[model samples]
Target: MGEILLPLLILCPLAASMIVSVSAGRMGACAIGTVACTGVGISAVISIILSITLLSGPPAGVLQVTLWPWMHIAGFSADIAFMLDRVSMVMILVVTIVGLLIHVYAAGYMRDDPGIARFFGCMTLFVAAMLVLVLASDLLCLFIGWEGVGLCSYLLIGFWYNDPANTAAARKAFYMTRMGDVALLCGLLLLATATGSLRIGAVLAAVTNGQLAPSGVNLAALFILVGALAKSAQIPFQTWLPDAMAGPTPTSALIHAATMVTAGIYLIARLHDLFAMATPIMALTAILGTLTLLMGACTALVQSDLKRILAWSTISQLGYMFLALGCGVWQAALFHLMTHAFFKALLFLTAGAVIMRTGHEQDIFRLGGLRHAMPGLSAAFAVGASALAGLPLVTAGFYSKEMILSGVWHVHFGLTREWTLSGHPLWGIALLGAFLTALYIFRCVFIVFCGKKQGTSATGRTSRLMSIPLGCLCFLSLCGGVIEMPDTLPPLHLFSTLLDPKTPLSHADEPIWLVLAGALAPLAGLGVAWVLWGRATPVMHEIPGQAAIIRLARTGWGMDALYDRVFVQPFRLLTWLTHHDVLAHAITATGRLTQAVSGRIFQARTGFLDILSIWGSRGTGWMAYLLGQLDNGRVRWYAAWIAGGLCAGLAMAVLS
Candidate 1:
C-alpha cells in the first residue's frame, strides 16, 4: 500500500501536467482545469490516507518506498525513493491539500485567460515536483526535485511572457535561486563524499557517530545553510520574492504558501542532527533569521501593494521557522510551517479574489470599505489577517508562534569558552517582529476593508470555487492549533508526539510572564492598528523624519539599490568593458590563421587535380583520333589494318 500510494502521489500530478500540455490546443479550459484539479485532489486524498495509517499505528513510524536504484558507482550509491515519516507526512498533507485548493481556485481565477492549459500544466507540475522534494529519502534525489521546483517557478512566474516585466521578474527569481542552488549542490556533494552515500538515514547516522570530521561537519552545514537562506528568501537574497508578484496571484500563493520558500526550512529541519553538531553555524542561522524577520516585517509595514505585503510577510514567517530550527526546536519550526501554509494560502487566494473582482486593484490605499461591497471576502480577509498576525489563542499561528517564542526564550548559545549569549535579546527582537507582523497585516485589513469607502466598488461576487477554499482554510486557521497548545493551556502534544514518541517538544522552565508577554504583543499591535486606521476618515499623522523612515521601509531599506550598486552595476560595467576583450581577439586571430591555411591547402589540391584531369583527357582524345582514322577507310583499309595488326602480334610473339 505504501509503495503504490507513494508513487501515485507524485505521478498523479505529473501525468496531469503531461496531459494538459499535449491536449492544450484541443481541450477547453474546463477540461484542462478538471484534469489539473483531479490530479492534486487524488494526491490530497492519498496524503490523508497515509496520515491515518501512520498515526493509527505508531508515534515513531516511517513508511518508505524505494522505486529503483538511482545511482551506484564505486563506493557511492543513492536511490529513487520516498519516505513518509511524521515530518514528510505533514509536508505532503500541506502541499497536496493546499495545492489542490489553489488549483481549484486558479481554475476560476484564470478562467478567462487564453492560456489556461499552460497555467494548469505548470501548476500541476509544480505540485508534483514539491511532492518529490518532500518525499525523497535520498539527498541526491531531493536535489532533482529541488531543481524541478526552481524550473517550474521560472515558468509560472513568466507565464505571461508577453510582458517584459513579468519575464524579467521570472529571470530574477531563476538567477537568484540558482545562486543558492549551486551552493546547495556543492554541499550535497560534500556530504555524499563524506558519507559515501546520499541516503538521508546514512548521512545522519554518520554525523551522529562522529564518522565525519568536525571541520567537515561545520563546512557542510554552513554551505547548506547558505543555500537554505537564499531559497527561503532570507537576508541579502529576498529582493526577488517581492518582485515575483509580477506573476499571477495563484503562483504567489503556491510559491509563498507551501512550496518553494519552505524547501529551505524543511531541509534544515530534516537534517537537524547535522546542524546540532555545528554550534556556530546554528547561532549564525539564528542571527540571520532574526535579522530577516525584522527586515521583512518592517518592509511589509510600509508596502502599499497587497501581494508584496504578503510576500514580505512570508519572508518574516519563514524567519521564525528558521529561528526555531537554530534553537534546536525543529518540531516547532515545522509546526509553524504547517499553520503558516494554511493562513498564507488562504490570504493569497482571498487577495486574488479581491483583485479579480475589483478591476485588478492591488493598492490597499485605493481599496476601502470593502466590508459593505464584499462582506464574505472581507470576513475571509479578516480571518486570514488575524491568523497572520497571530491574534492570540483564536488563531493557529498563535500556537505555532508561541511555541517558537517559548523555545527562543529558553535558548542559550555559548559563543566562546568565556562568553555566553542569551536568547532574551533575540526573543525581544522576535517579539517586536511579532508586533510589526500584526500591525502591518491588520493595517492592510483596516485600510482595505474597514474604513469608509474609497470609491472602489466590487465589480463581481467571489466565485464559489474560490469561496469554498477560503471557508475551509478559515476554519483550519482558527482550529489547527488545538493539536499543539502551549504549556499554559491544556497539554496537547499531538504534533510533537507524532514526530517522536519519546520527545514532547520540551522547553526549559520559564516564568509565566514570558507566555503572557508573547500573547500580549500581537494584541497590542492590533490595538494600535485600530487606533491608526480602523475609523472612518482615518487620521494621517506626520512626525519628524517620519517621511524618511517610511521611504526607507517602503523601498525595503534600500537593499535593492545597494545590491544594484554593489553587485549589478559592477557586473554590468565589467561586461560592457570586456564586450570584446583582448583574449577574444586573440582567439579570433587564431581561428583566422587556421581558416587561411585550410583555404590554401584546398586551392592547391584543386589545381593539382585539374592538371591530372587535363592530361588524362588529352591522352584519351589521341587514342580516339587514331581509332577514327582507322575506321574512316573502306573494307580494304580495314582488312589491311587487321593483317598489319596480326603480323605485328606474330612478330612481338616471336621476339618474346
Candidate 2:
C-alpha cells in the first residue's frame, strides 16, 4: 500500500488534468475543477500521513518507493522513485495545503474566465509536478519535476495569451529560469561524474565521507547555487519576478509567493550536507542573500501595484531563507519557508480579493481605508502584514524570522566552530536588512489598509469561499508560531519534533545583549514605519532628508537603473552587433556577390547567336560556295577558287 501510495500521489493530479482536458466542454468545467482539486487534496493528506509515520519510526527515516528504473549507465543510475522524509514532509505539506487553498480561491477568482477548465487543468498539473519535485529520490527525477514546474509557470503566467505584456512576462520568466536550469544540469552532471550516483542519499553519503574531490564538490555546489539563485529570483536574476505579477493573482499567490519560488530554498535545505562541504560557496550564498534581501525591500517600498509590492516582498523573504541556509541553519530556513507560505499566500489572496472587488485597480496610492468597507479582507491582509513585519506575537513571521536571525548571529559570532570559515561580519548587515524589511512591510500595510480612502470604494463584496481561506490563514498566521517556536528565549530552539527526532531541540548559547538587539531590530523598523507613514501628518514631510530617503527607497535604490546600464544595455548592444553587423553583413554580401557574377554571365550570353553565325559563315559557307562551283562543271576553276577562298579566309581572320 505504501509503495503504491507514493506513485498515486503524483499520478492522481496528472490523471485529473487529462480528464479535464478531454472532457473540457462536455462536462461542467467547475465540476472538473472541483474533482481535480479534491484529488490533489487527498494526495496531500496521504503524503502527510506517510511522512509522519516515517519520521516517527526509523533512523534513516525515509520511505523509498521505486516505480521503475528510469536510466542507468556504467556507474550511475536514476529511478522514478519517491522519497518520504522530514524535509519532503515539510515541502509536501506546504505544497498541498496551500495549493488546495489557492485552488479553492481560484474557483471563484477565475470563474469568469472562458478558459477556466484549461486553467484548472494546468493548475493540477503544476501541483503534481511540484509534488514530484519534492518527493523525488534522485536528482534526475527532481530535474524532471523542476522543469515541469517551470513549464506550468510559463503556461499559467501567460494564461491570458491575448495580453502582450502577460505573454512577454511569461517568456521572460521561462527564459530567465532556463538560464538557471542550465546551471543546474551542469551541476548534476558534475555530481554524477564525481560521485558516480544521482541518488540523493548516496550523493550525500559520498560528500560526507570525503569520497569526492574537494574541487569537484565545490564546483558542483556552486553550479547548483546558480540554478537556485536564478529559479528563486535572487539578486541579478530577480527582475523577472516582478514582471511575473502580470499573471493572474491566484497564480501570483500559489507560484510566485507560496510554492514554486520556494523550490530553491527547498533545494538548498535538501542538499545541506553537500553544500556544507563548500564553505566559500556557503559564504557567497549569505552575501547574495543579504544583497537580495535589501534590494527587494527597497523595491517593494516604491511599488504602486499591490501585487508587485508583494512580489518584491516575496523575493526579500526568500532572501532571508537563503541567508538562513547559508549561515548553516537548514532547519531554521525550512521553518521560515513554511511560515512564509502561509502568510504570503494569505496576503496575495487577500490582495486578489481586493483587486477583483475594485475592478482590477491595483495601485496602493489610489487605495485606502478598506478597513470599513471590507473588514474581513482588511483584517486578513493586516494579519499577513503583521506576520510579514515580524510584529510581536501577532503572527508566524516573528518566530520564523527570529529563527533565521538567530542563525545569522550564530554564524557571525563563529558559534558553529565546525562550519566557520572567513569570519565575515554579517550580523550588522543582516540586522539592517531586517530593519528595512519591517519598514517596507508596514509601509505597504499602512498605505493600503490603514489610511483614509484615497480612491473609489469597492463595487463588489468578497465571496464566502474567498474569505474562508483568508480567515484560516489569518488564524494560522497568528498562531502558527506556537507549533514551530522554541521552548525558551535568548537561546531560542525549535520544538519541531518531526524535524529533529533524536534531539528535538538543539540549543546554542549566545550573548544576551546580542539576542536582545537582534529581537529589537524588527520592532525598531516597525516604529520607523509608523512614524514615517502611519500618522495623518507623517514624518516624511517633517524631516529634512526624509523625503529623499523615501524616494530612494521607493526607486529600489536605483538598482534597476544600475542593472539596466551595466548588464541589460550591454547585452542588448551585443545582440544588435551580432545580428546587424555580423550576420546581416555576411548575408547581404553573399547576395550582392551572387548578383554581380550573374550579371556578368548574362551579359556574355547576349551575343551568343551572332558569334555562332560569324564562325559558320567564315568556314562552312565558303566550303559550300566552292562545292557549288565544282558541281557547275568548272572543276579546275572551282578547285582554284576553293584554295583562293581558303587562303583569303585565313588571311582575313589573321588580319582581324
Candidate 3:
C-alpha cells in the first residue's frame, strides 16, 4: 500500500501536467486550471495524510521505498527509490501545499490570458519536478528532477517570449543554474567513483563509516557545495534571481520563492554526513552565508522595485539557512526554510495582487496609500512583513531566526576560541543583517501601503482565489514556529528530533542575553524605519544616502558589472579572436582551393562520367582505383573490359 501510494506523490502531478499539455488546444481555461489544481491538490492531500500517519506511528528513522531498478552501467547502479521519513515529509508538505495554493492563485491571476493552458501545464510540471527532487532516495534520481526543475523554470520564465528582454532573463536564469548543475553532476560522479554506488544511502554510509578516502570526500563535498550555492542563488549566482522578475507573479512565487531556490539548503541538510566530513567546506559555508546575508540585506534596502527588493531579500534570507547549516544545526536551518517559504510565498503573491491593482507598477516609491483602498491586501502585507522582520514570538520567522542567531552567537565550531566571548565576525554580520532585513522590508511597507494615494490603480480588487491563500499563508507565517520552539521555552523540540536526530543542536538552550538580542534586532530596525519613512511624508525621489552608496546597493554592489568586466568581456574577445584567427584564415584558403577544383572538375565533359562512376559504384575511392587501372597498355583488353562492363550494367538496369 505504501509502495503504490508513495511514488504517486510524484506521478500524480506529472500525469496531470501531461494531460493538460497534450490536450492544451482543446481544453478551456477553466478545464486547464481544474486539471492543474487537481493534480497538485491530490498530491498535497496525500502528503498530509501520509505525514499524519507517520507521525502518529512509531518513529522510523528513514524509510527507503524502492520502486524499480533505474540505472545499471559499468559498476554503478541506483533504483528509482524514495526515502520517506519526517525530514523529507516536512519539505513535501511545504512544497505540495504551497504549490497548490500558487496554482489556484495563478488560475485567477492569469484567467483572461489566452495562454492560460500553457501556464497551468508548465506550473504543474514545476511542482512535479520539485516533488521528484525531494522524494528521490538516490543522487542520480535526484539529478533527473534537478535538471527537470531547471528546464521547467526556463520554459515558465520565458512564457511571455514576445518580449526579447523576458527571453534574455529566462536564458540567464537557465544558464546560471546549469553551471551549478554541472558542478553537482561532477560531484555525483566522484561520489559514485568513490563509493561505487549512486544510492544516497550507500554514499552517505560510506562517508559516515570512513570507508571512502578523506581526499575524495572533501573534493566531492566541495563540488556539491558549488552546485548548491548556485542553485540556491547565493552571492555570485544571485544576480540572475533579481532579473528573474521578468516572469509572471505566480512563476515567481512557485519556482523562485517557495521551492526551487531552496534546493541548495535541502541538498546540504540531506547530505549532512558528507558535509560533516569536510569541516573546511562547512566553515567556508559559514563565511559565505554571513557575507551573502549582509549583501542581500543591504541591496534590498535601496531598491524601490517591489519584486527586486524581495528578490534580494530572498538571497539574504537563504544566507540565514546556510548559516544554521554551517553551525551544524540542521533542524534550525530546515525550520527557517519552512517558515521562510510560507511568509515569502505570501509576500510575493500579495505583492502580485498589488502589482495587478497598480497596473503592474513594482516601484514601491511610485505608489502610496493602498491601506485604505485595499484593506485586506494591506493587512496581508502587514502580516508577511511582520513575519519577515521576525517580530518576536508572534511570527514563525521570529522563532526560527532566533534559533539561527543562537547558533551564530555561540561560535559553534568553525570560529576560533579567542572570539568565544564576543562571538565570530560572521555572527556580527548576521546580527547586522537581521537589523537591515527588518529596516528595508518595513521601509518598503510603510512607503507603499501607507500615506496618501500617489497614483490611481485598477478598479478590480484581489480575487477570492488569491485572498484565501494569502490569508492561510498569513496564519501559517505567524504561528508555524510553534512546532519547534527554542529548547528553553518549548513543549519539546519535536521538529528537531525527527528532522535531525543524530546531531544534537548546540544552540538549543540559548543564553538569555542572546535570545533578548534576537528579539530586539527586529525592533531596532523597525524603529529606524518608523523614524525614517513611517512618520515622514513618503517621498518618491530618494531616502538618506549619497549618490554613490545608493547606486552601489541598487546595482547589487555592481556584481554584474564586475562580472562583465572580469569574465564576459574577456570571453567575447577570445571568441572574436578565435573566429578570425590564423587557423581560420588557413581553413578559408583551403575551402577556396577545394571550391575551384570542384568547379573546374564539374565543367569538363569527362567529369560527368567520373561523377556517374562514383555514384553507381561504391564511392570516390572506388572510382580512383578504377582510374589507376586505366594505365594497362593493352588497348583490346581495355576495350573488351569496358564493353562487357557496359553490357552487364545495361542488363542489370533492364532487369530492374
Candidate 4:
C-alpha cells in the first residue's frame, strides 16, 4: 500500500485534470470541477493516511516509488523517484487537504466564469506540481516540480488575462521567482558537482558527517536560500506577492497562503543538516526572517485591500517560520507552517466569500457587520483571525506560534551566550512581532465584522458550499493546536512524539518568563486595537495625521515607488538603450543601405530606356531620309517605311 500510495497521490490529480479538460464543456463546468475536487479530496485522504502510517512506523525507513531512470551519464544517474518520510509526509498532507478545500470552495466562487474548466485544470496541475516538489527524492526532480508550480502560478494569476494588471502581476511573479529558480539550479549543480548526488538524504548525510567542506556547503546552502527566499517571497522579493493578489481570490488562498509560499520553509527545514554546517548562514536566516516579519506586519497594518493585507501577513508569518529554522528549531518551524496553512487558508477563503457576496468589494472600511449576515463565515473568519493573532489557547495559531517563540527563547538565552547579537535579540524581535501581528489582525477583524455595516443597507449571506469549508477549517483552526503542544505544557499533542525522537521536550528546560513574554505580546496588541478601533469612538475618522499614515500603509510603505525609482526605471532605461539605440539602429541602418542600393539599380534601368530612345530616334530619322531619297515621289517607298516601323513595333511589344 505504501509503495502504491505515493505515485497515486500525484497521478490521481493529473488524471482528473486531463478528464476535466476533455469533458468540462459538455458535462458543464460545475460537474467537471466537482469531479476534479472529489479526486483531490481522495488524494488528501490517502496523504493523511500515509502520514499517520509513517509517523507510526520506523522513523528511518523511507518509502520510495521510482517511476523511471530520469538520466544516466558516465559517472552520475538521476531517477524520477518519490520518497515519503516524516517531513515529506507532513507537507503532502497539508498540500492535499488544504488544496481539496480550496478546490471545493472555488467551485462556487468561480461558478459564473466561462473559463471555469481552465481554472480547475490549472489547479489540478498545481496540486500535482506541489506534491511532486515535496515528494521528490532528488534535487533535479524537485526543480522540475518547482518550475512546474511557478508555471501554474503564472497561469492562474493571469487567469483573467483581459485585465492588463493581472497579466503584469503574473509576469512579475514569474520573472522574480525565475531569478530565484536560477539560483536554486546553480546551487543544485554545485551540490551535484561536489557531492555527486542530489538526493536529499545523501547530501544531508555528506554535509552532516563532515565529508564536505563547511565553506562549500554554506555557499551551496546560500544559493539554495536565494531560491527559497524568492519562491517564498521573503525580503526584496516580497513586492511580487502584493501584485500577485491581482489573481483571483481562490488562487490567492491556495498559492499565497496554503502551499507555494510555504515551500521556502520546507526547503530549509528539509535541508537542516546542510544548514547546520554554517552557523553564520543560519544567523542570517534568522535576521532576515526577523526583518521580513517586521516589514510585513508594519505593511499589513496599513493595507486597505483585504487580499493585499493577507498577502503581506502571509509573508510575515513565513518570516516567523524562517526565524524558527534560523534558531535551529526545525520542529517549531514546521509546526507553525502546518498551523499557518489552516488559519491563513481559512482567512483568505472567508474573505473570498465576503467579497463574492459584496460584488467584489474588498475594502474593510466599505465592509462591516458581516457577522449577522454570514454567521458561519463570520464565525470562521473570527476563528481564523483569533488564530492569526495567536489569541490564547483556542486556536492552532496560538500553540504553533508559542512554540516558535519558545524555541527562539530557549536557543537564544538558554542554550547560547546572553550578550551575543544573534541570540537574545531574535527572541526580542519575535516577541515584538507577535504584538504587531495581534494589532493588525484585530484591526482587520474589527473593521470587517464588529462595527455597523459600512455603507450597507443590509447583511450579505454565503452559500452552503462556501460555509462548509469555512466551518471545517474553523474547527481545524481551533483543534489543530493539539498537534504540537510541548510535553511540559500539555498532554494532548499528537505530534509531540513525531518530531525529535532522540531528544524529548522534557530534556529542554525552557524558562517560564520567556513563555509569559511571548503570550503577553499578542494580548497587549489586541488590547491596543480594541481601545483604538473597536467601538464608536468620537475620534474614529478624526485620527491625527491619519491620512498620511493610511496613505503610506496603503502604498506599502512606499516600497513599490522605491523599487520603481531604484530598479524599474533604471532597468527600463537600459532596455531602451539596448533595444532602441543598439539593435534598432543597426537594423534601421541596414534597411536604409539596402533601399539606397535598390534605388540606384532602379535608376540604371530607367537610364537604359532613355539611351535606347535617343538612339532609336536618330536611327529612325536616318532611315526615313534615305527612304525619301529612294522613293523619288513613289508611294511604295513611304509604304515600305511604314511597314518597317509597324514590324519593329510588333517585335518590341513581343519582347516587352
lDDT of 4 by residue, 55-145 (tens): 7778676788889998888756788999998778788988998899888888888888998988898899899999999999988999889
Colliding residue pairs in candidate 3: none
In order of appearance, the predictions have TM-scores of 0.88, 0.85, 0.86, 0.86
Q: Highest TM-score: which candidate?
A: 1
Q: Could you tally the backbone clashes for each prediction? A: 0, 0, 0, 0
Total residue pair clashes for candidate 3: 0
Which regions in candidate 2 have their CA more than 4 angstroms from the true location? 412-424, 486-496, 503-505, 541-656
Alpha-carbon lDDT of model 3: 0.86
- Model 2 lDDT per residue over 21-120, tens place: 7788876756876877787788778877776677667756677898889888788888988898878888888888888888888887887788888888
Candidate with maximal lDDT: 1
Cα lDDT for residue 391, model 1? 83
Between 1 and 4, whose TM-score is larger?
A: 1
What does candidate 3 score on TM?
0.86
lDDT of 1 by residue, 1-656 (tens): 87799899999999999999999889988889899999999999999998998888766778999999977899899999999898899899999998988898888888889999999999999999999999999998898899999999999889999999999999888989999999988899999888899899999999999999999999999989989988899987998899888889999999766678999999999999999999899899998999999999988888889999999999999999989998888999999999999899989989999998889999887898888889998998899899988988899999899999999988898868998888888899999999999998988999888877776788978888788888999999899888988777776788887777787885546567887888899999998888888866566422123688878888888888998898789988888768958678888999999999999999999999999999999999999998888788499988987899999999999999
Candidate 4 Cα outliers beyond 4 Å, as residue runs: 412-422, 457-460, 491-493, 504-508, 542-553, 577-656
Looking at model 2, report the run of 10 residues with the lowest lDDT sum. Answer: 486-495
Where model 3 places Cα greater than 4 Å from the true spot, the runs are 414-423, 501-509, 536-541, 570-583, 589-656
C-alpha local distance difference test of each model: 0.89, 0.82, 0.86, 0.84
Candidate 1 global lDDT: 0.89
